[model samples]
Target chain A: MSTTSPSRWKTVRSETGRALTALVIALAVALVVILLTSADPGAAFQTLLTAPLSSNRTMGLWIDDVAKLTLTGLAFSLVFQARQFSMGVQGQVYMGGLFAALIAMSPIGATPLAIPVAMLAAMCAGAVYGFIPGYAKARFGASEIVSSLMLNYIAILVVNYLIRAHLAPAGTGQLMTAKFPDTAIFPAILPGTRFDLGIVIALVSALAVWFLLYRTSWGLKLRLVGHNPKFAEYAGIRSSFIMVSAMTVAGAFGGLLGSVFVQGRAFGNLAQNFDGNLAFEGILIAIVARSRPLAVPIVALAYGYLRQGAQLMGIRTDVPTEMISVVQAIIILLVASSFSLPGKKLFARLRGQKSANAATPEAAK
Target chain B: MIELLLTVFSATFFVTVVRTTTPLLFAALGGLISDLSGALNVALEGMMLIAALTAVIVSVYAPWYVAVLSGVAAGAMLGALMAFFHLRLKADIILVGFAVNILATGGTVFALSRATGGDKGTSINLPSKAVPGVDLSFLEAIPAVGPTLKSLLSGHSILSWLGVFMVFAVWYFLFRTPYGLWLRGVGEYPAAPEAAGIPVAKVRAWSLVASGALAGIGGAQLAMFNYIGFTRDMTAGRGFIALGAVLLGARHPVGAMLAALLFGIFEALAIVMPNLFNWIPGEMIQTIPFVVTVLALILFSYRAQRARQMRTLSKI
Candidate 1:
């Protein structure tokens, strides 16, 4: 047990080092781009790195984002651990939010049971959405990447259609549902801020996922299938069942994010185009955490801080907020890459050729 | 009903189909080449977005063709970058492609905002040039069916004609050439080619480069002709739809074009439908192509699985 603990610590340390290296490199690249574009690079950089801490309200927003990212990160991490790339988190989020709103706006929302019912509805919606791609992949051998992305577009459009047609009031001229009932909403947990019970949900979900992955037999089977499907099958594990269940569970987490977002302090009503690629950002968080359940919130906190900082920076400085995505892309590429590059190989090859030529000259001498 | 039928069957509709299909066909052909070489080229979307932005920005100062070429170069460079990460650095191809996409989505907007002096959404402030349409008015000189022939044959962007030629060229290169055979062999069984002294990695890398270049032209066509400017997220999943086209076309260049044309027709219908059917929600109509893509892919997967089952049974 002691031996295993030391090795695990080593792995954690190494992962953290690698993540830091990627972050530093990504930030350096962002700085260069900022210098090229901004007339006041100093101010932009300072704002990007520091502004999220400037006020309590900003800190509240940052913490709120942390909660959302933690949930999304878990959603991606669950399927990643099973070696499946669902990418349906975005669609699932939409479906979850739509169902949550449907429940939250109904007469049941006025009752004390409103929150749990809405949450369950959202999870079911997200699970159903997630299940479609998993079923398609398991039974028909369809590509999950393509199917999930296609479903994402369909879900967003469907949600938009439903809201515009059925939910929006007749003369409001807005594409949002009526404000959700106060009882159905998550009340603020902190004074002077919108931060609420969602953070607790995010933390509890992360803990539950960690327990499921490390303390449960199913997690072992899922990991076995991920490591070697043929061997897993030989060992009598049903790989297809695990794959579908892994995706479905991951999708439940994604669906939960929907209810959290809708019922959270961020927005009291369901609005069109509210996600703004938040689902995609979860993939980045998952990568940064290396798909480890316990590491997800830690990574989410760091990444969410940067995201919130960038949001504030966009308002205050000449730099655009989209700069964060560039940094995100660089971080992902660097984190996924091995340290050895082709440049080193080419350099070594050229040196070898030079040494060989020198040896021939010496022989001639 | 008569008016709708008249519009659908007219030469103008055919022209619209060709115009819309040109970009999809180019991207689909690109997707086919890379897929044949064992690279999925998911970065096609990002590459196209960057290329479209590049083409528009370049057109502000340079000639139209030069702007298009710049777009192609940008895409090819991105492809080379993807290849470096996937092949040399041992990164996952899908992840690398996604990274490129994220970069393109955010980076293009960043660059566009700088280029347009604070307009992050579009390049409207820039006086970008458009690809001149190929006017085949000379066909109007012919007596019989002159006007109809002119309408059918004229006023397409020059790139649309190139897109037609490229379908045949890609088909020939993928089937009729030794290099094409080598690329196919590499994709099918890399070990066999590697044993025969083929540079499998280099072939894949070059395929990715060529794929990116083709996607770049598609982007140029989109920015310069289809819409005549760059808009945020303007590609609007066309790159993804092109991937579907590649599968629906059964991995063949000719088939890819036909599949692209099929989608192009659906997209054209979406554009034309709002005016005729005002009662229908525009969002629902917009989803038709994506819905069709999902259904088509599901059907294709089912058929392919059955075919495999039949082959195994016959062997037994």
Candidate 2:
């Protein structure tokens, strides 16, 4: 009991130390970017640090960012946990949103039932999109990274073509779909914000993901396959089926992310470059969250805050919001790195000590 | 249909093919080098984007060659950074590459806005320099195919000539040289080379640098000569297409060049296809190259599988 408690303390200490180092590096990079680029670093820093909460409108925008980021983060985390790194989530998001928009604008979608139908269409589109890569990986032994990336461009093109050909109004200028009907519109929960129910949906999703992953046996099977597919196969588990299902589930969520983003706004329609790289950002969020389903909401919030605050800094100061991406990149490098910074060797030593206690069973033998 | 076919076979179309192929060829060579060194430089897109912007901004103040060199240097430095992070710091190569990619996406735009005084979309405002093309008008004085050859070969950006020569150079370096052998050995089976006293990490590090420098040249050619200036993400998906070329070309240098030429043909077709088929949306026409890339990759995999099956059948 005594040894277990000490080792648990060691685990927490090491984790915190690593996260702190990454956080420090990220902040330092952000600081340098400000000082080097901005004419008024002080004001930029203040706005960047506080602007997400500065006003009700900005808060609404921040919430909107969180809602979308959280969904994508969850989508990425699910496949990541299964050790099937699928970059197809964003493609699914693209397909999902395109389909949702298509359905929302259809004749049958004019009724009150349109919104749910649209959402379901998005889920199915995204899931089917995801299933392609998963099935290829499972059956053909293809590289998901490469295939998903290729599919992303395909999805972008397909959606672009569809929008340009059919849904786009016979107009003079821009190629975009007709505005979604009121049936597909979300009612704003907060009085002042433009976006609504998205945050609530995202929060509910986070809770559902937590429950599904931590409290369910299917989650156990998925984790087992992710950790060691050969071992899972040896135990009679169908790893290929699990991989396909996991990817399909991820696609559904990713699709839902796009729908939430589009429907929450008054102009609920698909644009040319509709992806906005939320899928890639979701990958970043998952990495930062250490691929934890439950930790996603909080991390997504923090990311959303940085992004929203950076937007404010762009408007209020000379700095560009792109600076947040620099910070985000540095954080990924530092967090993903196995090399503890010079002083952080102490924590690694602590980790080694904790592992040594686990060796006691062999020592007993 | 005849006119469309004529358009496809015209000398102008071949020139377009050469122009488009040059950047993809350079990037394909870069991807090939890193791939053969056991490090898939997935950051090729990011590296090219940063290098394109760097060259475009530098050209506003410096000579074309100097700007191109600066772009190469920037890419090499990034390669070194990737090596430092992935090798020394023990990070996953793909993730580190992705991080570099994400950095490139935002960093180039930020730097571009700063350089061009807040024009985030395009570098139309920069007083950028272009690489001069070599003249081959003398070839026209010769016999029958001379005029055709002159039309195909003359007026290509000087970098396009370098791109052609690099095919032989990279092939020689990879197949006919000892260092190339070491790089390949490191990629295929590192333990054997390590046992033979070769420094695997150093070879990998140099390969990454070489890869970056090649991609940098591709970026330079695209910005300085392909279009005479940079636009936001002007490299587009050339980097990824280069990866596809690496495989579709059978991971050989000559194959890569040929595959790049193949993709270039499609891009050229896209450019000319719009004029012939006005009914088809231009946006749909633009998708041809990307669609071809996905199809080519799938075909490549299928062919490889069939070949493997035949080999095993014969062995049995």
Candidate 3:
């Protein structure tokens, strides 16, 4: 036990080192952007470091962002865990939001009575949107990445057309539906913040996903299918069905995120491209967490804080909030990298592998 | 509808189609190169956006050709960076490509604001130069056919002619050259080439660089010739359409050009249709190319599958 403990500790240490390296590199790049763009780099960096935690109000804002990002991240984790790279999470979200609005606005329903119905309709729409690509991949040998990406553009445009044609109130001067009813809007739970019960739903769903992935026999079979599809088929597992269901489940989570977005009180209307970055953010969060459901919410919160801080930095300093995108990209590159300096032997292999990466970064020129 | 179709087939419409097709063709060729070398460049959209901004910004201080070269250099550097992460650091190629895309999306906005002194929406405020259109007025001096040819082909950007020449060039390089054979071998079965002492990774690296350079030129054409200014996300879905074109073209250079022209015709139609059909929303009309991409891909895949099954049956 003692001997094994040391080896385990070493692995833990290396993992920690790699994570820290990614953080350091990402932050350093962000800082360089700040220095280059801002007149007062010190103040800019300070706000970036502390603005998310500066006040209860800021904290609430950060957590509200985290709630939505967590749900989207959960949506991506479902498909990613099955070894299927579905790029349709945003597409599903777009469908969900549009369907949710349509159902909520239907004449047959009372105001409060329609919210749950809207959520269900949204989930169904998302499922259908996901199923198209799922079926294509399962039956036609088409690439999920390409099909889903095309679907995303279609979904966005279709939703945009729907909003303008049927949903938008006359003379609004913008392509958005009218305000949702009071019953549709989620109220703030925290006194001084936009934090709402939507977060509660997201937190519960993350825990539920964790349980479903770790403690269920279905999870085991699904993982087996992902680990080796041919072996799973030999073992009588319906791998294609699992693949489709994984996408369906993922779509459901995306739907939930959209439902939450539309139900906010102050900003209850869905706007153009409001679903921006959430899909990619979901992918990034899953990558950071190694696609573990339990770790997703944590990564979402961390990313949420950075985004909030970046926004604050934009307001307080000369920096742009878009800098966070560059930071996030670099973080993803570093974290997903196999290079590490923890072990001397491992370090040598990393150095020897590339003229681009290790020998000369200037080789990119 | 027949009258409308006839009206749409004028020299003006054909010229618009050629103009739209040039950028798509360049990007499609770029996609084809990387794809043939076993690296699908999903980052074409981002590369084009960055290069568009780069070319537009550089055109303020340099010659049009120099600005275009700068854009190509920027894209090549981005491609090299992607290879660093994908090949050396061992990240998934798609994910790395996506990261570059995300970086481009934000980085371009930040850079635009800096360059334009606060405008984030476009580079409209800059005094950018455009690629000169060729004047074939001499065709008017020749004869009867000269007037027709001048109307159809004259006034096109010089880049458009290069784009046409590039189609044949890419075809010859891919089908008639040793390096092209090596690239195909590397993509199909890298092990065979590796055993034969070819540097598979190096080939892939150079293919990505070439891919990026070509896409960069496409961006330059979009900003410097087609549109004459840079807008955020102006490449729009053209990069993606180019990818679909690569597949729809059956992954061949000549096919890529034809596929690009097909989409470009729809895009040209979109540009003109909104004025004619006042009732249909412009956004809805703009989706024609993307919708066509999906339908064409589905049809292509279904047909390919049936063909494969038939081939197997014949063997039996």
Which sections of candidate 1 miss by over 4 Å? A1-3, A340-365, B1-4, B143-145
TM-score for candidate 1: 0.94
lDDT of 1 by residue, B1-316 (tens): 7877888898988888888888899899999999999988888888899999999999999999999999999989998999998898767787788899888888888888888888988888799999999999999999998999999999999999999899999989989999999999999999999999999999999999999999999999999999989999888888888888887788899999999999898888778888888988999999988888788888888898899999999999
Candidate 1 lDDT for residue A160: 89
lDDT of 3 by residue, B37-98 (tens): 99888889889989999999999999999999999998898889888888888777777888
lDDT of 3 by residue, A37-79 (tens): 8889999999998999988888888888898889888888788
Candidate numbers, best TM-score first, in rank order: 1, 3, 2
List model 1 lDDT by residue over A1-365, tens digit each: 12498767876776788789889988999899889888899999999999989988998999999999999999988888888878889889999999999899999999888899999999999988889988988888777777888888999999988888888887788899888999999988887686788889999999999888778989889877877789999999989999899899988888999999888878877888768788888878887787878889999999999999899888999998988889999888877766433365578687775422221110000
Best by DockQ: 3
Which window of 10 residues has the lowest lDDT sum in candidate 1 chain A?
A356-365
How many angstroms is residue B117 displaced in model 2 relative to the true structure, after the best TM-score fit?
0.8
Name the lDDT of candidate 3: 0.82
Point out the worst 10-residue segment of candidate 3 chain A by lDDT. A356-365
lDDT of each: 0.87, 0.83, 0.82
Query: Which ten residues in a row are the worst by lDDT in model 2 chain B?
Result: B294-303
**Docking quality category of candidate 2 according to DockQ thresholds:** acceptable
User: Residue A47: error of model 2 in Å?
Assistant: 0.9
TM-score of each: 0.94, 0.93, 0.93
Clashing pairs in 1: none
